[model samples]
Target: MDGTHLFELVIAMFLAIIALHYLAHRLGLPPSVALLTGGAALAFVPGLPAIEVDPELVLVIFLPPLLFDGAWSIAVDRLKRHMFGIASLAVGAVFFTTVVVAVVTHVLMPSLPWAGCAALGAIVSPPDAVSARAILERVNLPRRLQILLEGESLLNDASGLVLFRFAVAAATTGAFSATNAAGTFILLAAGGAIVGCVVGYAWVKLVRKLHDDYLMIAATTLMCWIAYLLGEQLHVSGVIATVTAGLIASWYQHTVMSAATRMRGTSFWTVLVFLMEAMVFILIGLSLRDIVERGGGFGALLETMALPALAILVTIVVARFVWIFASDVAIELAHRTGLARSVPMGTGAATVLSWAGVRGVVTLALALSLPDAFPGRDFILVIAFAVIMGTVLLQGTTLGAVISWAGLRGTEAEGAPMTMSQAEAAMAQVQFAKVKSLAFDTDGNLIHPQLLRRYEHRATAIIDYAQRTEDYVPMLHAHFDVVLEAVAVGRTELIRLRRAGQIDDETLRELERDLDLEELSAISAKA
Candidate 1:
């Protein structure tokens, strides 16, 4: 496509995404599902051009930011607590599912080589990080379950893709070694993580010297791409590298960035992730045209390929359930015998986790990347597409219902209503004391009685509202907005004073930082 046409297509796709997002929000459907359906519908529109997505470009452009943002947002403490469970699912479950799917595919279609089946298995094994997170955010999963899912999605991409590379190589060369592949996986994961840490540390040091929020945002964006590209060039797992950088950056940002910088950087990443996710799903839908065309049309493809596709999809779903339950049982036995320290996994949590394995863009990209000469390439592609659609459309859509049906609602401890109330009460008392203390200046001179009275009244009202009302959140929000407005006005005056030579730039900056910190605190409180 020409540059002009490409630009036009980009604009059109974004517009469609916005429209579909609104529709999905109104219809109470997942945004990914809406985008996928919209893209498919657009494909069938007369005179609309079919846009082919480059799988390599998808990984290089979309994967890094998505992975980094997810890692950055994940709760570090929660992940640490559940590291064992997350590891078993992310690494072990992925390996097990890959093998199961490969066996089933080989049995169903004997003509396809074992290597090809393994490649297909690896392609669809890891749940899509973007899809899982997007759906999980909307549901009311228990805190531990949510963290486990998020952690698994964040790490499994690296494992699944590493396995994919080994399988592809084995298929092409007609040679394979379990020991060699295992060694390669370790080297790639460890090397990628080390590289990410070095890069993240360098970025932290560099950003500390910079004061511009926009510059900080741009620098982090550059860091993600550079980290991924560097890892790929070094023959390590780029997904791991990006995720590592993001986690390190997230931890270090609090120390290095000003409040304003951190807030702006967060907003930038949020918008970027939303756009990337929307584009990926829509593009997946758009590619349906090409897939259908290659198979000589939808009806012909289904007549020949439907049964195998359904079988593969069913196998993946069943494998996840088996692994989750089996692992849980073993963990329980170990705990009972005092051989391991582990919590008992409830049936509800196990069921929800099993049903949450929805495939997405990565699977489609890998399938499309298959060589033309590969055995059963078309058949493999068809099955991959079917599985992606089936899992995402059927399984993704019903996951929340399944969680509810299994009676896995958030527990009282997980909800933490009592803790939240206690915190709110403590915060109100602290603010009330601060307001009362503000009545006098540093010179020990009392502020004007009228102004002092107004501050005291507002503070007292907030405290009473917090103590008496179940719905005090709105009152708190109003109080926060009032403080924010006052801080914003002070910041503007500080800038004006510096511009008029009434204050030096250094003094102005010092005062501005104070205001920024106050504003950040208020915003955080409201959130």
Candidate 2:
């Protein structure tokens, strides 16, 4: 492709993704699925040159932000509740997959050595962060199930990559030692944890010193890359480093960072991840072009498809089912014995989680990073791509059905339930505490003494609402009489305009959404 043509293709890709993403949101499907399908559709264009970006660059640059954002959003206490199942799936399942795939690959492909098989296995073992989480969240699976799946995917990607690196090193060097591998794993993991915490905490302290929202937000974006690069230079797992840093940053985020800083930082990171995800899918489509072009015929396809990829796919799926079921039983037993903190899992939730495991960009990036001169490199890449597309596109599309069939869709009570009054009071108190942190005088006294009195008044009003939850309806009627009347009048106008065709369906929807938010806030304020 020429420079102009390539630029045109890039523009077209974004336009297609944005338009299709809007459509998907309207249809209540995860927008990621639509973006993947939309990108792939562009591949059907005659003689359209494919867009090719370095997979290593994609992994190192794009992955940290996504993983970090995921960890940041995850509530520490809630994640801890599902840690048992998550550990089993993330660590235990990866080990199980490596052994299972190694055995099958060696037996089926006698020419391929154990190291080569192990490398392939490790690359395909972990589920992808982008596609899997998007589909799982859309199903609205019980909150426990959602957290367990998301947490498992987030950490397992790190663990699996760590394992993959060891296998690749062993393969390239023609040496394999379980003892050395185990020792290295421990040191690397420990080192990453230490570095991540130090870096994250240091960043927090620095942000507190500056207290500039824009600079604080910029520091977060920079932290993801810094953690990854530092971990890589130190020969530790960057994924683990990034995840740990995100967790640490989030822990201090509520207390240290200003509200404006948090808002802007969250928005920036979300948009960055969204763009990266779209580009990754488009890259996947472009990758398929290379695979097909290089293979060139039915015989090449048949050769690559022979046995190993199929075995890996089957093992991954079956292993997930077994692991989830066994872990669920153990968790239930623990809860019964008064040893567990979270609710025991149900059969339906386990089944949904098992089927929801989907491979994504991390898997693809690992494949593309394989040394071209390595023995069986072609086969390894082929199998990795096969596993990625099979799980991400096929399974992702059907995840909602699995959730529905298993009767696992709904918000499960994972955290301690908060009453309306309790939630409001807690929030109001948090705001008051943050306001008190502002420094104005030489000795860090209050910035505005009058602001303290106003905060007190606002907090008292919030406390009053909580104390009269039962009388909220009447209280709401009394507090916002004028606003409610205006909202009612505007809603009536929107309905009339829609019926008369003066405004289109889209215009009516915008008006309704704004009205809903206004009403919800008013109602919640009364409580």
Candidate 3:
């Protein structure tokens, strides 16, 4: 298709995504799932030109920022607190699922190469953060449970994608060695982490010197790409690299960014991530026809690949449950025998975690990325799509019900603590200090009692007062600076609370948002 056609199609798909997302929200369905359905419908439209995406471009453009955002938003302290459990699920469960899916799928489709099966397995092993985040916003879960799941969501893609790269290499080169693969995986992971840290350090240091608002925002996006590209160039795990950069950046975000910069950057990232997510789901749907055609058409694809794909889908879903439950049981046994002090999660929470394994854009992107000459490329792609649809449609839609059935819905109790007002209430000390410390202007002159009294009618400064008197503008700005200082103190306290385990990540962030607005309001007070 021509560039004009491609551009038009993109616009059309974007419009469709907006409409479907709204529809899904109204109907209480997952938005990502709705976009997938819409994309599939658009695919079969008569006379519409085919939309072909370069897999390299897709990964390069889409994965970096998404991964970075996931890394940046994840609570490092909570992640550390729950590290062991998160690792077992994010790393162990993913590998276990990959192996199980590969073995079972090989049995179901013996003619398909083992390497291809492994690649397919890896494709479906990781759950997408976008899908989980959407549902999570609508329902609450226990703090520990939410931490485990969200943490897993952040790191599993790295593990699964690393495995995928190995599998694809094995397929392309007709070589397979578990020993070498394991060694390389470890080396790559470590190298990616190091590279990511360096990249993140450089980004923060560079941005600290920048004063322009838009440049700072643009630099963040650039930093994500740099992390991914550098990792890839260094022959490490780009996914891990990007994620590490994000994590480090998030840790220092408050200290490094000006209040206005932080607020604007947050808004920019929120919109960018949402758009990237919407486009990815729709692209997968739009690619459905091509996938089927390459697999020998719809009827032939069903006849040849349907059963094996079904078998693979079931294997991944079941494998997650088996591994999680078994691990929980093993942990429980260890604790009972006094062999370990780590407490096992409750069965209900375990069940909910296992069932929440919904595949999404990452799986589809991996499948689509397979080289054309790779054995069973089309077949693997179709299987990946099937797995994504099955998990998302079946598991995503009903995850809340499962949580409720498991008696961990957290509908009332868990939801109340993460509120903005709660965060503000926690900052009563800082607020009091802010008011008491507001006696002096920028020149350190204590205002007369009458001057303060006349300005006491409002918490916010009146812009007209600045026009009426030159001294009043500077005085108000000085008060704004005091407000900014108060915000800084609030941030320090928020960080302290997070580190001391006094507040959960959700609450910390909610409080951070409250302070951000206060700072912005102070700036606007004298604008």
Candidate 4:
């Protein structure tokens, strides 16, 4: 397409996304589902150009940032606590789903090569992290459960992509070996992680030397792309590399970068992720036109492939449910026998987790990446698309209701208590003391007795509120709102002063940044 048409297409997609996103929010549906539906509908509209989605662009441009941001936001402590569950789902369950999908597809389509079937299996196995997290945002779930879901989504793409590469190689070359593939998987995962950490450490050091928010943000963006590209060039898993780098960078950022940089970086990444996700889902829906046209239109394609697509969708859902239940049962048994320390995984949690498997962008991208000469490529694409649409539409829509029905709509009782970190409490105490000291003269005699008394009272209140108990939660929230309001007012005044020429732009910005940092801290405390 020429530049004019391309610009028009981009504008149309954005307009559609904005409209559908608003509608989705109002209707209590996942925005992704709404976007997908809208894009698909647009495909049949006359006078509208077909939007071609390049699989390579999606993988290279979209995947890294999305994966990195998600990984970066994940709490390291939560990952450690739910490591077992996350692994069970990310690695073990992904492989299991691949095998089940391969076996089922092979049985249903005997003429299709086993290798090709395996490739298809790997393509569709890993549920999309973006979709799962997006849907879960609307549903209340236990913290540990949420952690497990998010962690699995973050990690499984690497495993799935690794399996996909091997399957494709085997199919294309007519060669397959389980032992060799296993070794390759280990190398890709471990090597990619090592590369990510080394790169992440270097990137963090570089960022520490930079003071400009724009430069810091630009450098972090480059890090995601560079990490993925470097890992791929080294013949390892780019997904793992990007994920690892994001996690390391996130964990060390506070120590290395200013609070201003962190706050601005967070906002930058949030907008980037939102836009990327919006385009990905809409592009996914738009790509259906190509599939439909290739299969000789929608009706003809459905007539030929509907049953197989339905079967594949059912198989994917069932496999996830089985694996989740079995893992929970094994964990329970282990805990009872004192063989291991495991949190009690109730039926409600298990059910919710099982139903939360919604395939998304990764599946579509990988399916589209299949070589033209690959056996039954069109068929594979159709089935993959069907599974993605079916799971995301059916499961995504009902997940909240399912959670409600299962009675899994609260934070887990057995998980870590919700309390301020000791480090945070200490920092608050220090700040309070500093402020109180400012209310006194250099010799420590109170210059403003009322101010000294007020600071002391607030400090005590904060200290008491920081204690781990349910009773102080409301008081803590009230304190946070008050602090946030004060910071917000300070920011407004700084902006006004700059506009009125009472303060220079530089001074206004510096003071405004301080208030922004304070605001972020207060908001974080409330969360």
Candidate 5:
């Protein structure tokens, strides 16, 4: 495709993805899933010419910002707590999954080379953060479970990508070397880390010097994509660099950024990540035909796809169960040894985390990026696609079922009532603080005397309302025998009149809103 045609296709893709994503979100489904499904449909539709997706575009343009956003949003405290689990899952589990998938694929499909199988396995092993974040963040996984899953997902991309490089090299050269591969992996990982930190630090310093919110936001955004490109150019892991940069930059969020800069950067990054995530998934769905066509005939493709998908699905399920059980045992040992305090991993939390592991774009990108001349590339592509679809569709759809079966739903009660007195007191404090902040100048001199006096009067009324909150609980129980009984009575009379069609719709709606406020007050006071 030429520049103009490619540009138009990009616009069309973005618009379609955005519209579909909005619909999915409105319908209470994850926008990522919607995008993936949409992408698949777009690819399969007749009369649509094949869409050319550049692998370089994905690694350079897509991966970095996505990884950075994930790293940025994950809190340091949460990341630290789940550090062991994340490390184990990201570094260890991926390798284990890759090895297992490779061995199984080689044994099952003897015609496919070991190296090719390994490449496909590595691509499929790491769950996508985009998918995990979309699913897990919205669900009621315990704080700890959410952290563990997110941390693992965040770091595993680097691990998978690194392994992918090795796998590709092996497949292309028809050779494999343990020693050299291990050494290269370590060097690249370390080099990527160094580059990320140095670049991130420099970027933050530049942003701080500029002190322009728009410019800062733009620079940070550019850094995400730039880090990926630079890392790839250096032949280090781009995903690693992106994640590392995000972490380093996030560490300096408050220290380096002006308040306005921080606010605008945060908003801009959040929106950008959301849009990219939606687009990636949609593109994944749309590429179904690309995978199928590239893999050969549908009948032949299905035969190749079925075994690998089943193997991946089974392997993931079994592996997760073993990992979780072992991790739990380790957690117990740590508590016993006084290395950590015992924090219960509720059944719901554990189950949800296991089920939330959905494969996504990273796998598809790896599949598509495989060299055309690579032996058994078509088979590998089919298997990888199968794994992605099976894990995401089957596992994602049934995760909630597993959660319910395991009784993993949140224990926290929804919208629990609070006593009126407590609510009134809290609201009073907020009102008083706002008033005080407005009344006083930075030098401690009073400003706007007339407005200050009026504020003082309103503040006193808030204080009085706050005090009445203590009696609110009893008053509500006694049907308004204490504090503002007459006011409540008048409001009830107004509500009844409105209900009887004695007031206009707007007046009735206004009265209903007031009634809601009063009810909230009473409920708060009771709590």
Candidate 6:
């Protein structure tokens, strides 16, 4: 395609992305699903150029930042608190699904290489973050259930990719060694983690030295790529490296970032991640035309492989439910037997977790990476695509109803308290006490300190909220609403100041951003 055509195509794709995304929001559907469906429809349009997505390019461009953003934005404290459940779902269930699918696929197609079956299994094992996030946004799931699902989605992507790499290598070389694979897994995970931490810390130091908001944002954009590239160069797992770096960066984000950096960087990363997701998913959908032609027509291939593909998909779904519920049972048994001190998993939580296994980008990338000569490559691709579409259309669309059926719609599930992490009462009190000092200290006139001094005692509610005082929740929301109203007033005045030439655009932007942050915090707290 010529440059003009390529440019036009890009413009069209972006416009489609925006329209489909808005439509998804209106319909309470996951944007990834909407984009994929739209891309498939676009594939059949006459005169549209055929678009091919390179697997390596997809991995390099999309996985790093998306993985990084997921890691960085995740609540680290919540991750730790829900470590056992998250780890079980992310690590144990992923491997279990891989093995189950591999065994089932091999049985269903004994002619295919065992290694290729494993590769296929690894490809389709992990539920995707993009779809999961969309559902979570629309659903009012219990916080505990949300953490389990989100954390699992985040970590399992890395685990699934790592496993996929090993499986693909084994398939390519026609060799299988569990002992060697296990050792390599440890080394890759350890080495990648080390590389990522080094890169993350180095990035923090560099941005601190530069001290420019735009530069800081630019550097963060590079952080994930650097970590992944470095890890790949060292023969370690780049997926793990990117995830680790993101976590490290997140840990120091508050300390390293100025308000401007935080505001701008957040917006930049959100857009970047969303765009990459749209492109990857749509491209996968668009490639359907090529795939159909390559496979001697979709109908013929579907007729031949439909049963096996359905079986593999069922294995993937069933294996997740088996592993998670079994883990839940084992944990409950342990707690009852006095062998573990942790809270036992509730039935609702287990059921909700069991039903949320939808696959996406990692599966697409892994399937695409299969060499043309590899055994059953086309079959693997068809199966992977089928699994993605089936799961999203079935499980992703119904996750909210599942949550409702499981009765995990509140902060507590099955009478089990979802203990939220408490803010340090002292620290919160100190922060809120300075509302006047923070907002109007520069003006020397606008608002008196006494006007907002009443906010000081607001932080006292922190410990109560932490302790799950249901009655106190409304009062807290009311307080945040009042504070938000003040922020709106402050924002209007700040804009007026800029219009009247009392402040420059830069000053107005910075101050208004501070108010925006204040309003955001208030709204977030209320949520």
TM-scores of all candidate predictions against the true structure? 0.85, 0.81, 0.80, 0.89, 0.77, 0.85
User: What would the TM-score be for candidate 1 when compared with the true structure?
Assistant: 0.85
- Give the candidate order by descending lDDT: 1, 4, 3, 6, 2, 5
1-527 in candidate 6: lDDT tens per residue? 89999899989999999999999989878787898899988998998878877888877888788788888987787778888888888888888888999899989989988888888888998888766765666678766778888788777876787788778788777677878877877788899889988998898889779868898899999989999999999988787788888988999989989877898898888888878878877887897887777778978878887898789888888898789878878888898899997775578777777887878777887898888889999889888888888887788788878887877665542333344434356566667767756657565764655546556555656755666668777888898989999998999999899889999999998888789778889998787
Model 6, TM vs. native: 0.85
For residues 1-527, could you state the per-residue lDDT of candidate 2 as single tens digits?
77888788778877877897898888866676676666666765788776565777988877888888888888788788767777878888877777777777777788887888888788888888877657755667676777777788778887788778888888778888888877887788788888788789888888889857888888888898899888888888787888899999889889988766776787787787777777777677667767666566447776768466777788778877887787778878888899975565687778888888788888888888888877688888888877876777668888878878887656535457886567878898888777666635778766788777777777887788778766776756786776777788999999999999999999999989889778767766543
Q: What's the lDDT of the predicted structure labeled candidate 2?
A: 0.78
What TM-score does candidate 4 reach? 0.89
lDDT of each: 0.87, 0.78, 0.82, 0.86, 0.75, 0.82
Clashing pairs in 6: none
Model 1 lDDT tens row, 1-527: 79998899899999999999999999999998999999988988898887887889888888888888888888787788888999998899999999999999999989889999999899999999988877887799888888889999988988889888888898899999999988998999999998898889989998988878898889998999988999999888888888889889989988888877877788788888899999999988998999899999978988988888889999999999999999999989999999998866779889999999988888888888888898878888888888889988998789889988988766433434555555666676676567668867899888766766766676666557657766877787898999999998998899888889999978988888789788989999887
Tens digits of per-residue lDDT for model 4, 135-188: 866777888888888899989998899899889999888998999988999999
Model 4 ranges with Cα > 4 A deviation? 412-418, 421-426, 432-454, 466-527
Clashing pairs in 4: none
- With a 3 Å backbone cut-off (N, CA, C), the pairs that clash in candidate 3 are none
Count steric clashes of candidate 5: 19
Which segments of model 5 are wrong by more than 4 Å? Answer: 172-180, 337-347, 409-527
